[model samples]
Target: MEKEIKVSIACMTYNHESYIAETIESFLMQETDFNYEILIHDDASTDRTQEIIRQYEQKYPDIIKPIYQVENQFSQNIIVEYINHRRAKGKYIAFCEGDDYWTHPEKLQKQVEYMEAHPETSMCIHAAKRVEAKTKRKIADIRPFKESKVMTVEEVIEGGGDFFATNSMIYSREKLAIWPEFYFNGVVGDYPMVIFGALQGEFYYMDEDMSSYRVNSEGSWTQREFSTIAKKKKHYAEVARTLDEIDEYTDYRYSQAIQNAKKGHQFYLLLIQGKFKEIRQEEFLDLYNKMGIRYKLTSRMKHYFPGISRLLIGIKLNLIR
Candidate 1:
């Protein structure tokens, strides 16, 4: 009889030749009691990423399944999540891109144990470390809490797209199979996935840091999508619009929270576009009040010293990503 697979790891790659081997190695190192499969989808990479994946597939045919695309489907607007997910044979689906890896050998085992015990959770996420992609330097730890707790839909919306690390998520396949309308419509995947999962059932968060998230890596979404001011504006606009749709979908049950979340995105939009005066509007006071003293000083100086404030604002915007 075939071994029962408990987890299916979904990895999508483009030009991740330098990092794909490490990603696959991390998955292979998982010390799980149950069987698991690695499903890697290479979107017709021009580099050696596909070659590396094929090597691993040949070495571990039973555990590593791959889809080698003839042409780039992502550019054609095909969702990678759905493609790999359709072939998944596990109870839970874990996400890790080719550019990222898990730090803990027992990451999957620990998460699977917790998920099995808590049938109420539709998704589970843990803490992760953010590393500078080029230097591979440790930047910071993305710990959502000091202790384990359940995350609510409201909190998930407020946290935005970068709320939790993408590599740290393991969600129920059943929950994801029934994708919400908003999930299909959103420009980004991670934020919508968490929102849909939270709506389906509670999201249990473990406080352990077991994954490494490479920020602004080449071919990563951040690098490709937000490289220009126009792209940044468009991305934020789509996010806020998606949040509005979710509000209506939920019959305005979470309208207040959703509106606040949209405003937060708008705040960054205004800040980045150098509309410092508009940021002082009454509607944005809640976000403006929470700004640091130095930022507040800069905002004030924009009135007297427009040139210096504009230069400072440019520097600040670069760090936003």
Candidate 2:
């Protein structure tokens, strides 16, 4: 007889051969009272990713269920999430992508215990370390670092996509099933997903850090999209459109916050392309006025003295390194 699954881990991968092994091992290490399953959706990886996946699937046929795609569904604009959602059988859903891995053996067990006790929590999450894959150096912590144990939806939204790391979240499947159409429409993945999950109720947070978020790694969306100047411009523009649609769908509840995020991207686009004059335009009026004195000075230099603006901005960017 099949053990009734308590959680379905939603993981997606494409050409992550270098990192998939560690990801699979981490999932296999999860310890819990109720049975849990890892659902891996592989989108036509040209590397040895499928070979490694098959080996694990063969050994743990009941736990590691994977879908091997012939062609890339993401390229075709298919939300791979909806596909996994249909296949997931658990009462709860957790996430750990192919490139990221959990660090604790009891990660799942602790979260399951908490959710079973708290009837009102929509999700469970913990602090995560953002590790630069190449350098193996820990960068700045993923912020909106909460002093409170329970995170309200408003608090999560105020974090501006910095609150919950995808690899660190476990959500109630019942709440997820009732998600609105806007969740499916956003091109930005985790931002909208986290927002929708937070809407279900308060989220339970564990101060224990249990996972690593690999940033700017090869085959990561961050690295691939920012590989060229054109891609960064196009990517930010697409994000603006996607988030704008979500802002409309949410009835302006989070309108100002989302608009501010979009404004930051627009400024980055202008700054990178050397379009300094537009930084002073009316579209950015509200965001510009809200900035600190330093940023306000930068904008003034961008408009009045473009040459000085580039050098100063370049120096600031270097200092950030």
Candidate 3:
């Protein structure tokens, strides 16, 4: 006479009016026997997103609970609040955003069963089908590791280990509850959460592609253009700050700090080379010092020599552009 475990699906949305209905329909079609709830958090958007969500909430009153925000709180804040407040009753938590929809109806059932059977794992993640939203094309398939693997903090910090897409992760409530202050400030929040999960225990990886991850230019983070020198420098500074904060307490503290510092230095170089716009020499030099690049020759050598150090430092800049 034990109570059945419940799962809560945290579906966050912004202005995804075109895809919101499809996303909600997918969750409504889940073929799980156990009790499940879909908690939708909608940031204050000036689109028809609220209307669509209200429609679903009215139709599926028992299963769907919608939290429509009056003011705009970015994804980082919304996710933090959703995780803290909405996950009260569920023993397990899963995530899918408004743009992404679940492809497999049995995804919840399969993942919940796997986690229930395997107590050693803190979370279970599966493969996802990457779809380009504009063309509705299948760009690629993101697959997870073959078997259950224990990930170290260093591997996660260096971004070397296999990672599951945020939409595909199903984690235990007990594991998530430990980190109450888990809010991300940078462009990458999922990475830190995955690292935290890995540090807690082994992660189960299912090779099946059960979810779809839609990539489009309409979303909040993706829509902003960081092409200007000021914008790029500000972006890198925020990234460096977030990484520094993570490193301050984590085991791979020093290495992550060095990595962030190197990144800041490269961005500084780009700003100076007129690839972006001309920044103040003093300000640029101050950032270089903060990033631990004191010698002017060292900075010049990186630009002129074209070695591995230059390659590693300039990789992200090239990729973003």
Candidate 4:
């Protein structure tokens, strides 16, 4: 008979041949009292990603269950989470994308134990490290609290999508099974999913860094969408629309926080388009006021001294990149 699965890890991948092995290795390194399974969906990778997965599947047939798609599902607008949710049998489902990896071996074990004991947490998230993909240099730490604490729905709404890394998230499969229509409607999955999950119960946060979130990794949404100004504008507009819908769906209970998050993207939208005057409008005044002196100065320079600012910005971007 098959062992009782306590957790199911949902990993989505596309053309991550170079990184998928490490991702799978991290999952296999987990030490847990209960059985767990890894569910990987490869979206028709042209690379050797599927070959590597096949090797692992043969070695650990029961634990590594993968869906090798003939065509790309994400391009067709299919949410991989919903597909994996139907196949997941464990009580809880955890997320870790192909390009990201868990840093702690006990990550799953510790989270499962905590959730089992508390019984009130709708989701479990831990601190994660954000690293530069090419150089593997540490950029910043992604942590909301100085130490671990249970977070509220209001906090999650105010925190937005980047509050926690996707790899550090785990939630009850039952709660995820009934995700609202708004969850599906969002341009991005993680933010809305967390908002709805927050509605279910309080979020339990573990302060330790247990995962690594790769920034600008190959085939990542960030690299694709933010590669061009047009794409970034389109992405932010969709996000703003989704937030508006979310506000309405929640009956405007979190309207202030939702608006704050929405206006932030609008600020970026105007800033990137060189519409500095528009950013000071009533809709974005609060967000504008919150900007640091450096940003304010940079905007002024970019607006009034476009030629000089463009040269300076080019040098700055080159240094960072």
Instruction: List TM-score per model, in order.
Output: 0.90, 0.81, 0.71, 0.89
The model with the greater TM-score, 1 or 2, is 1
The residue-by-residue lDDT of candidate 2 on 91-114, one tens digit each, is 988888889889999988888888
Per-residue lDDT for 1-321 in model 3, tens only? 634548988887878998889899888889988988888888886899999999988888878888888887773344543443345568988888888889999999999998888776787778888887755567678864555455455544544222456788888878767652433454456666666676667766788888888876366444453555677667656656666666664655557534845454565547456433333355355554554444555655655675965776579546644
Stretches > 4 Å off in candidate 3: 1-5, 75-87, 144-152, 160-163, 180-187, 225-233, 253-321
* Model 1 misplaced stretches (Cα beyond 4 Å): 294-321
Q: Which of candidates 2 and 3 is the stronger one according to lDDT?
A: 2
In the range 181-290, model 4's lDDT, one tens digit per residue, is 88788778999888888888878889999999999899887887678888888787888888888888889998988877876777777887778789889988877888
Question: lDDT for every model?
Answer: 0.89, 0.80, 0.69, 0.88
Q: If both were scored by TM-score, which would come out higher, candidate 3 or candidate 4?
A: 4
What lDDT score is found at residue 97 in candidate 2? 80
> How well does candidate 3 score on lDDT at residue 267?
52
Model 2 spans > 4 angstroms off: 146-148, 267-321
lDDT minimum window of 10 residues, candidate 1:
295-304
